[model samples]
Target: MKGNFNHFKILIVDDEEEYREVFKEILDEKGYITKAASSGEEALNILKTHSFHLVLTDLIMKGIDGIELLEKIKEEYSETEVIIITGYGTVENAVAAMKKGAFTYFIKSHDLEELTIEIEKIRKIFYLENDNEIFKNQQKNSKYMLNTNNKKFIKIINMAEKAANSNVNILILGDSGVGKEVFAKYIHSCSERKDRHFLAVNCHAFSDNLLESELFGHEKGAFTGAIEQRKGRFEAAHGGTLFLDEIGDISLSTQVKLLRTIETKKVERIGSNKTMDVDFRLISATNKDIQKSISNGEFREDLFYRISTIIIEIPPLRDRKEDLPNLIEFFLEKSKLELKKQIHTIEKKVMERLLSYDYPGNVRELKNIIERLVVLSENGIIKDIDLSKYRVDSERDTKSREEKIHNNKEVEEIQRIRSLKDIRSEAEAKYIKKALEISGNNVTEAARKLSISRRQLFNKINEYKLR
Candidate 1:
């Protein structure tokens, strides 16, 4: 797993001790770390304590046949690629093993040279992936900067940097868009594994079944459309850091599996019986209140305790308004460069209005507004009118439509009276208005914010008969 190349740990599994010894002798000459197993049961047991990069398994083994061994290996130690070895008569079984996730197969009659070539291929792939991660880490370090002037925020960042000195599980609690991922990356950048891979996955994005496959990997035919064997995020993040965003969204079943993996440093791929050893520092983030979730029986308390060995809570943008200026300045220059604009300053009044406004979407919303200004402002200085145009009105409009209808009977009647189409139209109009206001009434910018075509937004504008 370490070193540039030719450092793969390999296991050879065969019922015939003689064949196993012969394979070991040939592989030893190639400088690979080789271990031999005489039966499928022995191979399974050996895999529990040992971590191997590849396994050369024989197909006609007695007791737990090769096909069964292949399934077990793919399920548990998915990080280890399996190659099925068979005689001419068992070629059919070898093909079946491939469908079940064997990496590839070799014929017993063929020269061992063929097996050596396959091993070399796997070695090259490992080197390429490792080097790519190092390169990406270097690139991120050069371009990303965590700029903050808030004293409390600074102290928290300092704590994170100190935590990075040791291997500890980190839990980041914050509202969305508060730069949780920024802190996660900062920790990784400061850690000893800085040069290794830093991978992140949003746990809320996939369904439970899909998430299982994403975290634990799957064999070629593990499920429909699996098509080919794939490595999960955990496998990819081995010897590095893995940031699981929205960890609270994972189901209880997944929480159990995750807790086990953290405890044992091993994982079983979906539909695989083999277990793979993984070493990674976990960093998880969730916008949801985890304590509240545990009380509601939606999250596991034990898992929470396991992951929160170190907790860092980031204050919302509204609470940490003191950091606004530096953040604004950073985004201002970024927008200018991105848009190739000459805008360099905001009017004093405009700056005051911005500082007073509540950013419900936090830093992400602020950056979006800054970019809009850079692209639309005719002058180098953003004026008061520009600030007014981009301001979100939800803070100003305290009494929403639903709030005005206080009577339960009236609310029920209104809901019953309005068709789904009519209600959807009304909501769409409100959002369009809000998007238009936030984009300074620029149709193109509003369309972009709504993630719709400019022409479609224009059509809706006409349909609603909006000025």
Candidate 2:
């Protein structure tokens, strides 16, 4: 099933039937899903219909030449690797193809063995950087930055600050990379404990025993290699804030001890019987559903209720993309200053392309992408054409794009606005229908998510006829 995710495609365009067939056969046997075309025209048509990770074309063609195909493919599909095959392999033709985004040029008479290694390098780029930007920038808003203009973000941040003004435990839940730590830091910085030490630890990074010792400290010769008295994160964070990241990944055995410490506000260090009273604001974060983990026996139900007295679910990047331009400006400035480059001003078209892509990795991914773009961006402008080498490979598949548009229309058309009063009802019905379908129709869960009273939700259910 994991192999299903790595399935890649390659397109071959060659006038020689024998060479085309042999290359396709070799690539197919080597696990690449391959396609073959006899001419550049056929190659273009196939490319529009399906996505390819790489395309290999012969320099000499019967009709519309390979150089033109390279230009079109580079313009249309920047992420797709292109290799040119030529019998002559002249300096003039080689330079032209390379300038037009030809990854490598090979002599047709030579062995095709070197081509595989070249393809592997392109594959690494896909794995490390693939869809990372698309996920972050799919919406027009930058997901990574706090939106000053967004009333929702401002409201949430203000509410979080108010919550931090107290001494209560808070739990933050959101998709990974949603800036849980960002908000945590905001709470800490704005709280009465701003001047104190604000320590944070990733609960998932260590095993049960190691995490316990890290949180609770150890005396001299406690367990293995405990030669001196050690101060735990709790002790160090005393009278301040202790931020636990990815708290959902903590083991069940570790959860019990954590619950005990959180409940008692006391810790007995290892190899010592001294019960240390710890005072700190606990701020835990998880990308997982604590209730689901509790149901699955992976987490304690009592701990779930105890830590989530004040829960904040961070929104995904797509929902608040209106802040992207500001974030892009900030990131570009940072990249320019750090990289010592005179990069300034990105083209509007490049911003449009960035907004059009989905960014699954959230703000962190966007920062990395902007850093790369700044270093690679030519001249003073980061134009769409300059980013031609970094578009999502699937975006080149015109057929799939059309299919997505059609599917969205089909879903939207179902929202029948029977009356002015029913417009809100209709849209709500549509989204509730979708989320329930995606979540397999657990009404209690859906009601909790819709943030509506179960009784009010049932009324809407009856109004919309959602069984």
Candidate 3:
């Protein structure tokens, strides 16, 4: 019942002056900015001059009827939502109005409660659709990526900021889950097109035919499932930004069409002869090695050059170990908020393990791990976590690297003609010491790292006097 409706303006249109005045008065009392138009023609005139979030128009009116006005509003001001007002016996007409793009219709009645509720829902939708609100939320959640201690990443951010001022295409190269989309949005937020839409498409998520139709749109009857004409992302994102994620995964044929669209600034809907001009900033991202892909003829070299006018490469999380503490804190607070838990402390061993583990999935994996820990936490403390569940591949990779190190040492020791028993004991002791160091001398973590039980690790410690 209590809400802020000052930002949303509503126009009440009805042939009857009393109905328009009464509805406007009630809406005004509810804190909504309201305007009244006696006829649908007057409503259209007012709309041409000012913006309104929702149009409340009577179905039966002189000159232009509600349906006619609704069609005009949709064709001209597609963003505005409409609600048709009808008499008791005109429910069928209201239903028809809905199919023609009315948000919802209501019967004219003394009680205004249902109308108010519908208005509140539309206001909430508008709030979510607001680009500024979305940008603020993104800034709150992705601030960790923007503010980092890594010098190379700081340079990348700086380059992105500078690139945002220009109308150049950008290609973000990084591993999966490295916040490529976040960086793309950051660039869009800083750019001149910040107030407009920031549309993102995952090129890897769709088939070649589907992706083509998705980007270029389709006319009615263009394909078997195409029932109505639809505008594509390129057209919808006019005067804004379009982020193509996993661009390297798009088929070569799609790449050719994409390249032409970029160069011509025009898009032709599928099965349509007419082309519409579109202007939007382009930001692309991919985890694949695009240069290798191009060499292998998997990606177009020319499209690569066009999209990579300003390339920004983000390093993997493992390479930026220094920023882990801040990243952990961010995700911890975010998870706590999402999970609605009051976690106040992280045990030293848990923190150590979290800090030492190499996240192959990057920031996204770290976020998921934190959420899992929060879910499993007890007594408002995060003490124990089975990171092995999330680190299966990372553990395997670590073991492979360790084996290479052990093998290199074994070859050197064999060259020196050392006894095999002595060599084995020395290598085991050295490996144990290394794991203990990596685990920050935590016995449980060291044991886990060595793939042994705590008692076994303690026995080894005592046998070698390694404590």
Candidate 4:
């Protein structure tokens, strides 16, 4: 068990001096730079003076219990991992501590082997996470690909690339989580204007006037909050590709201005009559059916024709079940590297169960599921994943999703023939996709409707393979 991580820094917190000293002596014997604190306040003060890679704290104390300490630690130092120590007397509190952001928990008076092993595991994970971030950043900074190791993705990529090389205006159609933005980036990266800026805008993020000002330049004092002159996406991306994500979500008035920009390749800034030429390529995405919006009179017809010269529809993940194996492998490797866990493999049972899932949210949802497992699973292997605990197999989850879309009320009630896991997973996926559609992929808005955190939404996005 002796390894390079022997030099890792550690902190132990307990109100009992003898208990703290005992653990400190044991840890020090293992060559760790160990520190001890008698209370949460004392630990916080010590933390302010110094930093440690890991903190091991008792779950209960007189002042500022372990849960509060965990909260404070997570808030101040997001990178630092903390584990809660509990006796049989307060076992539930220890588990609650984990939810509050404690990395792991331990039962006091038991063997210290698990704790020691967990520390080494976490230290390795911390380093791996650092490396993974660098890798992801590099991928972002450099040219991005479709991340598709499959035929359909390859064909889609080819189609988008061809459209980009040509002079056709592109309208990318897909349900949310179908990697529309990734496809958009691919088109830009492969285009002749690859050297120019690629500007992407979510049409629903701002109010009509604000969205207008964002697309076209705005003069100072144009509106109450217009404090300074600003260049819009059209101007900034003059010689590049302008990506309009969720184009169908924009208001009717804003759509008129957008039509003008694409039709004339010119824009007039707000509060100014000066026309500016924008020699740029146009690419737009929409989860909604523009034809429906047009029929409903919520979208502009001429603009739809103008943007749909080349239309590419992305397939949802459920339609491409064959790619599940590769996607899982990709996410597994990604999570292992990111989480700094030697999770070299997943259990056959878990994999088989995962493959059975419909994954309504798509690739994004799958990543979140895998990330959650990587974080919460004991040891380096994810064995018996409690899908029910994760809301993956809940009647409430599936019911809410179906109610939102199919009936706008409730669908015909039927006896649930499938396992709770399958039902819940399908339900959760639907909710995410619909939320993205409703909120136009604005994380905050989606979180509001789903009643989850932006972080949780982000996590689920990756877990369920939503995108």
Assess each prediction's global lDDT (C-alpha) against the native: 0.83, 0.77, 0.85, 0.79
Compose the digit string of candidate 4's lDDT tens values, residues 1-467: 22345468888999999889988987887678889999999999999988899999988888998999899999997878999999998988888778888888899878998888888789889876765575446446333324555688678777877887886789999887777777777777778987666778877566687788988979988878777788888998899889998999998888888888888999888988899888999999999978889999999899899999999998888777777887777767776887688775567767766776777667677766776677656767786554444445334556676667675433444443668778778888987886687567888867855545676688789879997
Tens-place lDDT per residue, model 2, 238-290, is 98899999899998887888899999999888778889899989999999888
For residue 191, what is the lDDT in candidate 2? 80
Q: State the lDDT of candidate 3 residue by residue for 87-201, as single tens digits.
A: 8888898899999999999888737899999999999888866756757898666665568888988898999999999999999999988899899989998899987889989
User: In terms of lDDT, which candidate is stronger, 2 or 4?
Assistant: 4
The best-first sequence of candidates by lDDT reads 3, 1, 4, 2
Q: Which stretches of candidate 2 lie over 4 Å from their true place?
A: 1-144, 383-467
Off by over 4 Å in 3: 1-132, 392-467
Task: Give the distance in Å from residue 346's predicted Cα in candidate 2 to where it truly belongs.
Answer: 1.6
Supply candidate 2's per-residue lDDT for 258.
Answer: 88
- State how far residue 293 of model 3 sits from its true place (Å): 1.1
In terms of lDDT, the poorest run of 10 residues in model 2 is: 135-144
TM-scores of the candidates are 0.59, 0.54, 0.62, 0.57
Give the range of the ten consecutive residues with the poorest summed lDDT in model 1. Answer: 392-401
Clashes of each: 8, 12, 0, 25
Candidate 4 stretches with Cα past 4 Å from truth are: 1-153, 391-467
Q: Give model 3's clash tally.
A: 0
